[model samples]
Target: MAVELQKKGNFYMGEAPGMMEMGISNKNLDDDGRAKRTGTLITASAHIITAVIGSGVLSLAWAIAQLGWVAGPSVLIAFSGITYFTSTLLADCYRSPDPVTGKRNYTYMDVVRAHLGGIKIQLCGLAQYVNLVGITIGYTITASISMAAVKRSNCFHTHGHHTKCNVADYPFIIIFASIQIVLSQIPNFHKLSWLSILAAVMSFAYSSIGLGLSVAKVAEGSGDVRTSLTGVLVGVDVTGTEKVWKTFQAIGDIAFAYAYSTVLIEIQDTLKSSPPENKVMKKASFIGVSTTTLFYVLCGCVGYAAFGNNAPGNFLTGFGFYEPFWLIDFANVCIAIHLIGAYQVFCQPVYGFVEKWCNHRWPENGFISTEYAINIPAYGAYNINFFRVVWRTVYVIVTAVVAMIFPFFNDFLGLLGAASFWPLTVYFPIEMYIAQAKIPRFSFTWTWLKILSWACLVVSIVAAAGSVQGLATDVKAYKPFKTQGHE
Candidate 1:
């Protein structure tokens, strides 16, 4: 009797398994069987910038205020390095073999579920949804504030600051959310490349304008310049518990400022794997980080020098929307445009998660398949469906409502950073890398990395606590829902 059996390791009867294998998926191809490769190095870099830089940059001066000159820039640089390292780890984990086929995990949850397990997947999904939704709310708040600032500036020339300025965030939130609702229909992250570039340019525009204004203020001796080795310590500082709490809060803020890791895998999925996948991603990461770091350092130090401890959470607010008013208006416009795009970029993953669940639960419902591609001019072909409209609209509405209710712009930033930044940015990447790299638990490198991970956990805990304290304090001190009609 002749018995034939397939070898355990052999994926094929006699052919050796190659290093990489192709599999069909929505991400891998368009409708016409053409391989989908959308983002280039430039566009990838643009996505990175649009993802990394947001309302968080506006909070850097306030972050510097928390840590003072000595620790402020130091923490920003350190987090940048840390985030870059973790992001590379995520990039590495993007591709993995599934017994006979290789697959690219498109979302953060996919990575966790693949390496970790279902429990971690659920937790990651929770953290990511909260992080993304909370972040959108924060952006909404910031956009409204920017609009309000411009309006106030425009109005102040006619009606003074003292003249009962009741122009609230409600109107601006509705208008901006309307724009976002329309833009959210783009369907794919890679398709938003031009928008990402536009957002990046806008980010630079506002940042440059802010930096130039700040430098002019300092040069002319028109603004306060407080520079010292220990500027924060020198003053009558918040001693005891409050000081320690604020320090933790500052770490959280810095973490939030550097966090694009949560969406790194999704963004990497947008790039073509032709130029070696990790290489393209790393280059894009380096470009985006370097540019944003430069902006953060300049804006933080200059804004700090100009306003010292008095620097508002948004440095633009510190500028008070005064002369060169056109620049301020333009900067705010840039911010508004950038946030609209940023909202879509970040929310794409969230939508995917929801849609995936819905499709699995109600596979027979025929909610319009997203499997095939429709060709578009600039963004190539994309899979658009009716579900995109319904789900994303609901998502936008929810975020808009939260923004209207909380409207605690800066406070919410600290809260989100503290709560989500560690798990998504620090903890997940380090753990996943150790698992993927097969690093021994007690090995010298593993021991050190584990220690660093633990340290991050501690920081995250303290930061969360401190952020909660700060939020509560703000709530008691200041009223939420600034709009009277909303209340």
Candidate 2:
């Protein structure tokens, strides 16, 4: 009469008498019966850094330039604070009834389901997946821009800076798509720690280079840095309507820069359960956000100082720093490398969602479920799924083509930020926290949270409108795949 016990979420349940005879041991499995999670603070931080410090960082200088001296830094800091707060709230939602021992919510959608459990889940999924897809597209455009910048930098050095270095972005877009097609085959988030680490390093590398060059430009008294209290004067710099749209777009760009909540739970799912995933995630968020905010302030402010009212949408690729041609080329190379890894970080969830749905929908089909073990001499035995290869390749190709069609980087980033910032980053987390914590109706805390959420909603709406206007303007003059140089 031996009693067999199996651990569930926080309780152990009695199994059938002969369960142990099946030779299954709980020692190597977690409560949910998956392989033990081995993630630590470092790995989780790497993932956050990889996701947060992405192509969005490149547009901050332009964003700052649009908002001017006071509003630029102020908005950046406010976004950082809000992101960190919402992140902490989202972290606690990683588990259910209790923060530490409750059932695990694997994805952001899972969290919404557990707490809200309605059409909200579908809304969350839509916001999240669409944002992820948008980010991948944005990254593609950015990577190609960086690639083109490298060639342009070398060209500028050879032929003068005044020479028209009209390098087409289509070829570079294809090259970036080719690189992503290979990297997208990385099975899951658990296997991306090393890649995340490398990408984080590249992010820091290019960010530092951008910062250094901006500082150099300022110190040398290089250009006419015409900064005003309010950014881009109405008539002198831009029309009144243009100023308003640029300002709103700037807000969206900053919003996009702080966006990582969509992937926070995914990152938390990788953590080892000892120190508690929520605690570890909070610390990681603090570290990641703090580090990136410091970089953002430096890059945005110094870049503004360097180029003033003429700050480029992309700090490095915008030809603002042309003298140090070699340095600029190196920075662009780092940007391309960093984005290569970042593309996977954002898109892995999308890949997982599609694969999971396919497997569930057609469980018995070998085409979707089968993984082939193909031996590669140098790389050891690898499991290759024909479906994954085809699907992911097609996905990358589609994104590449779309990027070529509309490669307006700043406007695109702003639109993505505006679209996802409120729903995915702010509203969902606050709602989940309020529901889980059981805050009383009309209570002080509840009221404040509602106000905060609504305020962000307003921000999102304005940002989206601004971005749409910018896109309309760009499209009127844009020639799809024929876009070249800094048009």
Index of the highest-lDDT prediction:
2
lDDT of each: 0.73, 0.87
Off by over 4 Å in 2: 1-25, 480-487
lDDT of 1 by residue, 160-179 (tens): 64554456778899998888
* Every model's TM-score: 0.86, 0.94
Instruction: Give the backbone clash total of model 1.
Output: 0
State each candidate's clash count.
Answer: 0, 0
- Tens digit of per-residue lDDT, candidate 2, span 146-240: 99999888988999989887788999999999989998888788889999999999999999999998988888895467987787788888999
Judged by TM-score, which candidate is best? Answer: 2
